[model samples]
Target: MSAGRVAVAALFVVALVLFAAVEIASRREGSRVPSLGDVCGVVMRYRVGPLPVGRIAMFGFWWWLGWHFLAR
Candidate 1:
């Protein structure tokens, strides 16, 4: 496979593993993942003031930009 495809596949696997780890940690801690309300609250707060939404939007935006520029 080409380098770019390989990189994407590896990143995909890494993301899956990270997500699984988050889920496991959440279960062990007896704390649930962020709810829609939480995310909405974050967005609302962000609009009112600058706050780290945990880089969620930035990650998605950069991922989109990368795919737009790099993926054929």
Candidate 2:
């Protein structure tokens, strides 16, 4: 796969692993962490592109930050 496809696959895997770990941990330990569905919903909403330049730039930054901080 190309770099972009690899990156996207990695992101999908990471999100699934994180969601599973957090969900199990929260249930077993009685913590207050958010559910996987809710978190994924929020993330999907934020991933949508925009109609304006500034909005697109901001969304680009948001996308950058997610990969920068979350991806290994």
Candidate 3:
């Protein structure tokens, strides 16, 4: 594999590890770390004027991801 691909894969692995660690920590008793759902809930609660900015932003993110990785 090329060095660039290797670097990107390593970064993706690190992100997954960090996410798993945080998720586990959030589940432990008396731990302060928030679960991913909690964070997303808080973010999605925000609004801009009449629009749900957080929700729109999330939709945009998912759309972008799908377009880039799933589209042929």
Candidate 4:
């Protein structure tokens, strides 16, 4: 494999490890760390001028992600 591909794969592995660590930490009893769902809930509860800005932003992000990555 090319060096660039190796680097990207290493980064992806590192991210997965970090995510797992955070999730495990959040699951501990009385842990102050928030899980992914808690963070998403907070984001989804945000609003702007009677509009659900957080949901809109999330949708936009998914759309953009799909357009750039999946629509190729």
Candidate 5:
């Protein structure tokens, strides 16, 4: 594998470990850590017509980023 691919894989592994660590630490602390969904729900509590502007912006960014990387 190329160095760049190896680096990406390494970072992916690190992210997985970091996510697991966060879950374990939060459970041990006996504190309720709000998840991404919870935060988004709180942020978009306002009615922005039929669809929320935040959701449109977030999905647009995700779509653009995925296309930019995968279309290469």
Candidate 6:
């Protein structure tokens, strides 16, 4: 694979592992929520193979929130 694809795959695997680990840790610890960056990073990583669904969903969610609320 190309360097970019390898990097993306590595990132995706890391993100997925981190996301799962963090989520499990949070549940065990009780009452702490993961940060926005963590979630978005996971989504971006997951989309690496799929080509843009994750990215689009992540950005679209932000856009809707900004448009409906923050932009006001």
C-alpha local distance difference test of each model: 0.70, 0.74, 0.93, 0.94, 0.75, 0.78
lDDT of 1 at 15: 91
**What does the lDDT read for residue 58 in candidate 2?**
60
TM-score comparison, 2 vs 4, better candidate: 4
Summarize candidate 2's per-residue lDDT along 9-47 as a digit string, tens digits: 999999989878988876765678877666655655563
Candidate 5: tens digits of C-alpha lDDT, residues 32-60 = 87655566677666458876777777778
* Candidate 2 lDDT: 0.74
After superposing candidate 3, which stretches have Cα over 4 Å from the reference? Answer: none
If candidate 2 were superposed on the true structure by all CA atoms, what would the RMSD be? 9.7
Clashes of 5: 0
Question: TM-scores of the models, in the given order?
Answer: 0.43, 0.42, 0.89, 0.83, 0.53, 0.42
Q: Looking at model 1, which ten-residue stretch has the lowest summed lDDT?
A: 45-54
**Which candidate, 2 or 4, would have the higher lDDT against the true structure?**
4
Off by over 4 Å in 4: 67-69
Indicate which candidate wins on TM-score. 3
What does the lDDT read for residue 42 in candidate 3?
86
* Stretches of candidate 2 exceeding 4 Å from the true structure: 34-72
Clashing pairs in 4: none
Residue 8 CA displacement from its true place in model 3, Å: 0.5
- lDDT-wise, the better of 4 and 6 is 4
**What's model 2's lDDT at 26?**
62
